[model samples]
Target: MKRRIQINIAGRVQGVGFRPTVYRHATAAGLAGFVTNTPAGVLVEAEGEDAALAAFSALLKAQPPVQARVETFAVSDVPLRGDTAFVIAPSQGSGDLLIGIPPDLAMCSDCARDIRDTANRRHGYAFTNCTCCGPRYTIVRALPYDRAQTSMAAFTLCPACQQEYTSPADRRFDAQPNACAACGPALRLLDKQNMPVPDVADPLAAAVDLLRQGRVLALKSLGGYHLCCDATDAAAIRRLRERKHRPTKPFAVMFPSLEQIRAHCEVSPEEEAALADPSAPIVILRRRADSALPAEISPDTHDLGAFLPYTPLHLLLLDRTGPLIMTSGNQSEEPLAVDESELTQLLGTFADFALVHNRPIVRRCDDSVLKLSGGRRILIRRARGFVPGAIPLPMRGPPVLALGGDLKNVFALTRQQQAILSPHIGNLAEFASYSFLKTAVADLARLLQIKPEIVAHDLHPDYASTQFAKEFPAHTHIAVQHHHAHIVAGMVEHNLRGPVLGIALDGMGYGTDGTLWGGEVLLADLCTFHRVAHFKAARLPGGDEATRHPVRTAWSQLVAEFGDEAEAVAAEFLPALTEIERGTLRTMIQQGVRSPWTTSAGRLFDAVAALLGFQGEVTFEGEAAIHLQMLAATAPLPPYPFELVRQRDPWVISFGPTLRAIVQDLRAGTPPAAIAGRFHRTVAAALVETCAALRMRYARHEVVLTGGVMQNDFLLDLLHTGLQARGFKVHSHALVPPNDGGIALGQAAVALAKFFT
Candidate 1:
């Protein structure tokens, strides 16, 4: 009984050796057919005995290529074509674009071995790559991912490389980026002035020597450039920080192996798995107390962002230098440098020399970042190794484009039931980052060939994303409220269509009433939400200046609690503030000059931190709060007392009692660590109590925790444990970030739901 079948497969099926795997299995099973890449996915037509065909299908299901993810597989019987042998067919460009674009992958073990073997032809080759691992999203210029459509199109394959590429059994067969030293892109060493370094026998070795000498090198990577320096050299790390103008923010360190990482950071099983996963993201881990790494790498925190080498260039450099600080090559708050011009313009003063390659990066992507909270891996930044892969929507909807919030921006495009989020686009406040956002939106839309019917953006009218949405051509435009989007983002991740009790906590979001909102509780579904409960509001004196200097916010909190006595309390707790500064701040609070009220849990953390002896303005977002968390980690104190004023429609969780207790503790000479721990415990307790009450009133046992403040692992763990103990289902972010980076997904989901409604 000879028969034929046509199989259509979707997902990450192209540019990952899927065709070769199919060819080998079909030949082994004695089937005659062809496998070709199509706009929709991979299509295979096989003609053979029923038994052989069944075996082939089973093998494909059981053993897909290492990097291939089969999301959908359909097989149907077709009339037999009496072909003599199996063959790989050319890709088809017409049809619906449904296939997943492969993200940039880390170097595979086989490729690593090939680059290290002395006798291997690819030995010491900086651009060595195979089907399993190499640049994908960054180099791809168009779809039906063939070599001719990629950055590799410029490099004509040499004879030996072409033989391997044409051989069906070879791993390099049809691999778009497949190349050897003779034909592939090569590296070049240049000075700060962009002139080539002459007489360099081995560029990689010279680069390593420069690192050992504590010189900063701007090195091109799979996605973008990284400014590199030896991690152990305090002077070098300090110099790099000074040159880059990044004073206090932690830097990601790339180690040669997991063994090296284990020596400096406390690697749990979950953290170890994430560090070695195929995506190879930078995993945040707690540094060991006895670690010998220089403090300049990560200041004011116990955690270190560490990762294994994801590229041969990084591997080669780290093999000689034990560890290197691999921070993004960009000026402060700008997008990552992706080309020579960008490198020189952004990192010219910072980098002593540039180690660059001839291959052009079609797109710029930063490294993805992750951390474990309550044994669940959470994405801090989604890019590079984990982007351009679609996340399944709860239901199908029309194509929609969502422009995310202004900070930690990431955009999303919806196709039927799938949502494709763009890689991390830095703060949209900077001109370079904003330009990158526009470019990324256009690039992703063109690649997916999606013409969005609806455009979604944040409710903030002043955001660049919102402004762009106003001008983007679409049939419909939606304005999604900031906190509402945060809650819905968590619901989308969990595939929930519920009126869940949502706790949205962050620094600031424009409220519906034109005030600032952050600590909010809402009864929300996909489309709409009702304000249920919220934190008591406090005046933010000096507007944005109060955020930069937490002491001003602390003074405002004191005034809210003790009125005129706040000045005397400020003298005792905030000695850093001068008497004149205090008098001026009082006038600001009294006259409501440049002051706005906010219900922000983030601002509360800053106030408490200031009261606990933290001084001076913060250098980065969440710096004061992060310092408080570090202090809290050292103590295990019970929660301070809090009050829930339930007389209003939307009840208020007041921190007046808690603030008074914190002041009393300071007066009693209690350790700052104890006060910090108590403050954290108080916040967790108040949130749990509010949720339990809301669950009883609304009969909704499901609770969602989201927002940038939820990134605090310590608070998340407590909230999760407390809610679960009270017999409620608790959901937190795992797939996408809980910060504004994940806002686009929520915006898209809400817009689609509203469209159907």
Candidate 2:
């Protein structure tokens, strides 16, 4: 029988103790072998009795380490050579670098146990991690994931720890971040002036006590710093809000455990699984009606963004502080602070104390945000435990870079059958966010060793990302239409090819025709898309000004429907509107002066929310729409009337009937909640009917629902359920965000298709 075999394993093998596991299994099978990490992937050579080798191979495939994900394992025969023992050879950097980089993982159970055990050497160690888990993407400076190439290079292992590193039986075998408290990074408490605090018996306890005192603390984490305070303290929460300049934006909380989370909010099985998973992200859970959480925590919202501790430091702090407001460690619209100097400089004025750590965070990845859709997790903002992890492409193409849209910006770099999207970089309207965008792109390219031949960007020239794309020298820059990218992203995410109906719904996008587009129906594939239908055009008085003040948009809609009679009705609905502002808005809409026409579904929600007297001026991007969706009742209601008129090539879906019905309901003294519920159902029914009509003409049943408006779980649930009931194959985003955060993936995928197909 054959006695020798060589195997090549790819995908998430380098940083996950894969080679050590392979060596142990081979030795147990009495096989003389050696395994090593290569630039491409992991390589192993085994020589032993045929049966023993067979068992070894089976073990490698079936019983790999918990963190090791073997996507491709290939075996080939090799000539037998007598060898003494199995060994994990030193990693080789030579080869074409095509390996998948592992994202930062949560601390494993073993590490957590060691950190908690009183007798263990690593007891109370905040950065305790084994080979199976810990920072990877955040600590990594280059490929071949060795300690020498990471931020941990500065911390050498102690003698006793070195024994664990060399022992195959030990959990810390070949652990890149392996170290004891004597040699590894240490925590220190610093005042606002960046000087270490005096006479601190325990820094962690001191930090917790500070938090208990309702003081804002800037605490260092694996990826970056976080501004933290007691979540239940209303005064402290209000102070943080004022300091961060984040008036109405909801803050994410870090609870100690699943039991504690269940105590506050309604957590479904799906949400529980997500919270308990290795990549512990912030899961937005629906708060219980009787929840005792302070109103200031979520302020006018039904859902709370909650996450379990992903690190030992967080665990320790949470053990002392029941729950903490753990938000990004930066001012509003700026990139998250990573370095100590940067954190101190940016947060010193606000944070009462800085809980600093010496463990350098190479990359600044913010906490990821997600929620459930149809019993499955949907990412809102992909970061921290999920960044730099490549999404498999349908096919390989020339390397390309795609700069996403203005809001919720995320860029992507494409390579052979994979697209690695950047973490959420906020809006590019701010200089700091724009700067982060540039650094993220360059850092991704450098780390992955990608030289992009083609660049992709949005069609809008005014977008900062679009402008950034143009600055890339010697690259072919392709401008993808904003809505087209939104639709195609859903297609690429689901690995769909050929034609599918795409319902692109969001706030606004730069249309190919130059008018603002949001609500759109398109026939899309990887290469291109064709707009088939859209919402009827309505003037956005004062353009972007109409977005912040929903009353102006409501006035625009009312003027579109009732003309002069709209003023009297508008006065009744929007009591906050000043007559002078109302008159000016009316004149702007009538004269069409700087009033850009838009077919935006988001605007419709804004108008409806304004009509229902929910919000006059939005404090956040989707504040009014989010409030409207939350106010909607679970009981199903009959949809309001809407018209699908085929007056032009692409039929216009008019909201005139819906607006008129809403006006009547408001005059009839209907509850705003009832109107909101009916409005949501109406939008869903209208979209479903439009899809049915499109199906009759195109005969395509698969519809991909995408865009920022799809973030509304109420509308998404209704639309997804209604569309599926009509015998249609529906696809919505789960891996990437439905918002512009996912636009880069679509852009990159399209560019690859155009070049290769």
**Candidates in order: C-alpha RMSD to true structure:** 2.6, 2.6
lDDT of each: 0.89, 0.87
TM-score of each: 0.94, 0.94
Q: Where does the lowest 10-residue lDDT sum fall in candidate 2?
A: 93-102
Global lDDT of model 2: 0.87
lDDT of 2 by residue, 1-757 (tens): 6578999998777667787788778878888879988867899999988899889999899988777667899999988887778888877766545353578888777777888789998898888888888888889889777799999998888998889888976778978888778888889999888889999989999998899999999989878889999998999999999988888889998998889899999999889988877678999998988888888888879799999888888887898899999988886767888986687675566798998888889988988999996775678899877787778888888889999999999999988788889988988998989999988888989988899999999999899998899998635889998888988888887889959999999999999899999999998888888888999889999998889988888888988898778879878888878788888888888898999999999998999888887655687789989988888886888999999987677888888999999899889998889999998998888889999999999999999999999999888999889999999999999889999999999998888778775
List candidate 2 segments past 4 Å from native.
Answer: 1-11, 24-64, 69-84, 89-100
The number of clashing residue pairs in each candidate reads: 0, 0
